[model samples]
Target: MNARLVVVAVGVGLSVAGCNVAGSRLPDPHLSGRDAQYMALVPTADVGAAYERYLVDFKTSEPPGSIVVDTKNKFLYFVEGGGKAIRYGVATGQEAYGWTGRATIGGMQEWPRWIPPKDMLERWPHLQPTADAGGLPGGPDNPLGSRALYLHEGGKDTLYRIHGTNEPDKIGQSVSSGCIRMRDIDAIDLYNRVKLGANVVVI
Candidate 1:
């Protein structure tokens, strides 16, 4: 069977209701080196097959290679044009902390060191210790799990990211402060496909 057949067999429905919280098998062809090693030890999340990555029939005006994040549905779409896109499950920001707007992928990193932003520290004073300690080093234990795509707006760092998350179980929930979170493996997959300065639309 061809790729299209495979997608059809896997089924393609971007709906968020009544999803099963069961782990889905995923491909790691893009993973390598430290990414492979660390991700191997991270347990797969039960985000359900609906939330698993898939090449689906999509309708969007965004050009191919651009990212459109549906914050409401907890899904992110990497537009592939021709009415197609690669959809990945995501953990978006909570209502009070949500951010929706256009941005660009100004920076990208693998196993990126995470320094809690100043505002984040202000919001949660307990994290001041981590901030004073110069933040957490990147690894499986870090909140920014395996990769980070820094979002920038108006040529300035927006302090928001579409990055890997240590809290994989939150994949389909609205739980983060503001950044978008993906499973470690999925982050690596997206990292491989995204290029610097690519457009990102969060809605």
Candidate 2:
């Protein structure tokens, strides 16, 4: 097989954002804002009780609304002050596909579009690398799902994001390219709560 084909095959099996997930179910982007569509997209796969939304007793000096990604446990925590946090389940990068360090939520969007970076295309040359990368527009199958939080450091785009993913099975699994992937509901909730310029620590 050609390199492109090899990469494409790998992507389909290892990552869900390449528009090729096993037993895919994506709704029209227009309905993304709806909560019903999210539960329908993956009926059997729930992020589960451990990953459910809840306020937990926690200790953190950071003020509320701060985002913390505990990739080892596949959980994202939104600091809610007073020794409390709203925890959400997430799908982090697989193996060596993750990123770390500190950044701020420099920007946010609803039903945001996805444009595969050049490095992404280089690894998966089978992808168009243009047009569709940006053309995939925000929607149910858009990979970005209902919301996105762009992480930046020192006012510069770090290219890492906390966003929504449609692939349900990917939840709690190391299955993304790099960005932290949360369910549509969880993402929308985070999007609604996280303040712009909020500190994000991916540890």
Candidate 3:
């Protein structure tokens, strides 16, 4: 073979080898690292639809002192009266469908830690240690992203939360274990507005 041709062949071989190595190390963009922590949580097709609808302008007629949670539609409306309501996109319970009735916002927190429930750990052994350890630290990576509003009824914790999620893409779907999740930014805005001990009516 010609000397120049032989050199070109060797260069081509090295290029092919480099391409293979680079491809192997590339991470899966579709699967987020935080997603692994919540075993039951998964992406749904409805999330995209929720985002689009939320952006569009619509007339809201809910009255003040009422909380309307349209789970199927993925919206949480805090009525401000006079044919107006503050609408917030939310992620609802994945398994516990259509939670109705009234409750109160017992407490609120910023960057709240997430403690896995006993039943959750029992179902998924991977969460055993974390369950006993108390909970995940409050941060961007935490499932509860920025804020949490604890729900109570008759002065007892209902174990339900209106909180923030790091998974902004999952907003507006039934994808959480049971908590109502909002985007981190939106939740922070809400956290500032809603007073503690406010009445919350879910529909």
Candidate 4:
């Protein structure tokens, strides 16, 4: 698949910016009891007011329930129909490892295990043992955090994911391998909403 530049719809407006007009973080109703409990144990970083989750008046042609990722803006929009989307801050891939295209949500996992890919192990040989041993288990210290949405194309795994990150400070930055990274809270929220076979467009 080839990457193409997509122009965002014009006249787009934000419906609710950063929890409230004051930009303070608040408990989200989307979070479950388990999600809240997990969050309480993790050390979270502020990703700035601009990157906070919000409900926006999205003017996108994509159908409702589709995910549109604006890598340039470090935002991921979950289309909610009726000109609205739930926008969440995300951490994208670095320049050398960036990927953009369309894929379906082929699989989903809660507290996914992390197997450092072959390339990643080659880059950092010290991780080879973990990879050989069947990767790291999912937990508070796991890089995959609370949930993962696997992207696939044509019935094949793309090896890229939209997953929760242990490093919340990385949100709003392009510092990942090739996957999209979100805060644990945001990941859980998205994971709960997204279903298998849902469309994901990253650009």
The Cα local distance difference test for each model comes to: 0.79, 0.69, 0.60, 0.79
Off by over 4 Å in 4: 1-37
Candidates in order, TM-scores: namely: 0.85, 0.78, 0.68, 0.85
Scored by lDDT, the top model is 4
The digit string of per-residue lDDT tens for model 1 on 1-203 reads 00010001212233333343333344665666887788877756688777888776677767789998888778888877887777899999877778887889999999898887877777778988888889899888889988999988778787888999888999989899888999988898898888999988887
Q: How many backbone clashes does candidate 1 have?
A: 0
> Per-residue lDDT of 55-162 in model 2, one digit per residue for the tens?
565566666788877777787878877766767779987665777777899999987877777667777777765556455776677787778999887788878789
Model 2 clashing residue pairs (backbone): 29-139
RMSD of each: 9.0, 10.4, 21.8, 4.6
TM-score of 4: 0.85
Query: In model 4, which residue pairs have backbone atoms overlapping below 3 Å?
Result: none
The list of candidate 3 runs beyond 4 A from truth reads: 1-65, 96-98
lDDT of 3 at 74: 73
Which 10-residue window in model 1 sums to the lowest lDDT?
1-10
Query: Which runs of model 2 end up more than 4 angstroms from their true locations?
Result: 1-44, 129-133
Candidate order, lDDT descending? 4, 1, 2, 3
